[model samples]
Target: MKTPETLLLNQEQIKSLITMKEVVEIVDRTSKDLGVGKTINPTKVLLDLGETAAYPPYSGFMNAMPAYIGWEDSAGIKWAGGFLGERKALGFPYITAMILLIDPKLGFFRAAMDGAYITNMRTGAQTASALKYLVNKKKIKLGLYGAGMQGHTQTEAISVLFDIDELRVYDVNRQASEKFAQDMKDVVKGKIIIADKPEDAAQGDVIVCVTQSKDKFLKNEWIKPGTVVFPMGSYQECDDEFILSADKIIVDCIGQVLHRGALRGLVEEKKLSEKNITCTIGEMAAGLKEERIQKNERILCLPIGTGAMDVAVATAVYNKAVEKSIGVKFAFV
Candidate 1:
């Protein structure tokens, strides 16, 4: 009898297996599936280790996100962890994670791979999916509030979908924004400008805030009436007023958003409730709800990042890797 082997895909290998364009389509379809109840994405389980003597006043945490997509017959869980103090002291990334893909029928693990890149790309793809339904304009002036990994992918994903006439980026570290412009110069066919302030970056047709700041830096007055805003960060860059003032608020998952995403603070404070949400991106994608009906509607999209997206993209990547024979194979004894 032959021993079974499992596929192992590293970050670079997985990157070569998938493209941003394909990821957008996958995430878009996943949203529709979610709307139609074709997926199971449970709430992410989080474990927080409060400040210790070694890292006093700082904290570490880990989260387990699990999902199953019925249409694709894929199931997986992403396990990720991060420590703020370690990032600052060790000069390491704040988050690191991996995904384990399960054989839906056999009930065994089939593949394992790094999930950090997938997480960033899928998040951007989710934003693109929301933009497809919410933004009516064919061309847009893009405003970016952070120039980190998420910002880079957000710009890449959006530029893949729409023609960006102008891209204004702002970051506390000027070098970060400069690097972003340089890295994307060949990719984005538009004028890329560095903004001196967050407000300057917030001025555009479509604004995306991806900062990790705990305090709100985006002001409602800075946003134009017709602008579409995507606060994709972890409820860090937006305030209650900005959220409440939007004409239509769309979320990836209402349940997750209310407790973990941009709306978490508002929900906890009783300033906003699920009733205020216009609809889930899934609902809009599935045609169960209307998209931007009015030209002047200020639409805000808050996607907390879902586990179903991880499974969906991971499944696609795994299939592609198998077809291309891209991953390393190890026998399971």
Candidate 2:
């Protein structure tokens, strides 16, 4: 009998192993797997731990996301937690997570690695992948809301696919947006502007909101024709009018969106359903549905960030690690 061992990788190790472009490719393939029904992804189970007098003085939430990418023969689960207070007090990241990759055939754990990088990359990659079907232009004015970690990744990933002629960024903290512009100027080929208001940023050809704000900030009036919008957060960052009035609404997963996140409120209010969505990004990627049929159509892309992507990326990384003899491996049983 062969002894089993599981590879353990830290954030730095994993970062060295993969690139954002690689993650985008993995995410695009995972979407295709999802479209072809080769993926098993359960709705994320969230544990809302209200403000507790714990190590961090913040209302925190944790999510258990389990998924299987049958096409890749990969299975894994991501455990992620978010504590907003840590950012304000300790200057710590708001989100932290880990992923466990399992051997599907043998049902044995293969690797354990940091999930934060994967999480960030996949989130941005979702938008980039979806945009491949949504946008047809080469040069675009990109609008970004929330100038934080997500903002950076979203810009980085999108810059890989399209030439951002202009990047207008907005944040509640003006300094953060300024910092974002300064940091991303080299990445964005054209220009970086700090928007004075959310609406200013919303005027881009491609608009994305990655904020945690519960209150709606994006208005339908601010949106222009032929624009693709990505509301990447759980809450209602965009008003009901904007979500409902869009020419087409596409999501990563209809069930995941309805169960929780961006469009949940509309579902709960009996205003939206799976039928209302035009098609998933995956479906479009797989050629099962049409995307960007009209040049002037307004599109809304809700990518809730699926675990199948994590599984796919993690599995690929694990295989590479084994091939290159990277990371530490410990005996199992």
Q: TM-score for all predictions?
A: 0.94, 0.95
Best by TM-score: 2
Instruction: Report the number of the highest-lDDT candidate.
Output: 2
lDDT of each: 0.84, 0.87
- Lowest lDDT block of 10, candidate 2: 49-58
Identify the runs in model 2 with alpha carbons over 4 angstroms from their true place: 51-58, 86-88, 293-295
State the lDDT of candidate 1 residue by residue for 1-333, as single tens digits. Answer: 464588999999999989999999999989999999999889888666542224345566667999999779899999875667756588876667899898877767888999998999998998888888877787888999888888889988987799888999999999999999999897678899999977888877889988767678888888878788888766548767778888888888777788775787788899889899888999988889877736667778888888899889999999999999898988666
Extract clashing residue pairs from model 2. Answer: none
The count of residue-pair clashes in candidate 2 stands at 0
Residue 145 lDDT (model 1) = 87
Which stretches of candidate 1 lie above 4 Å from their native place?
1-3, 50-58, 331-333
Clashing pairs in 1: none
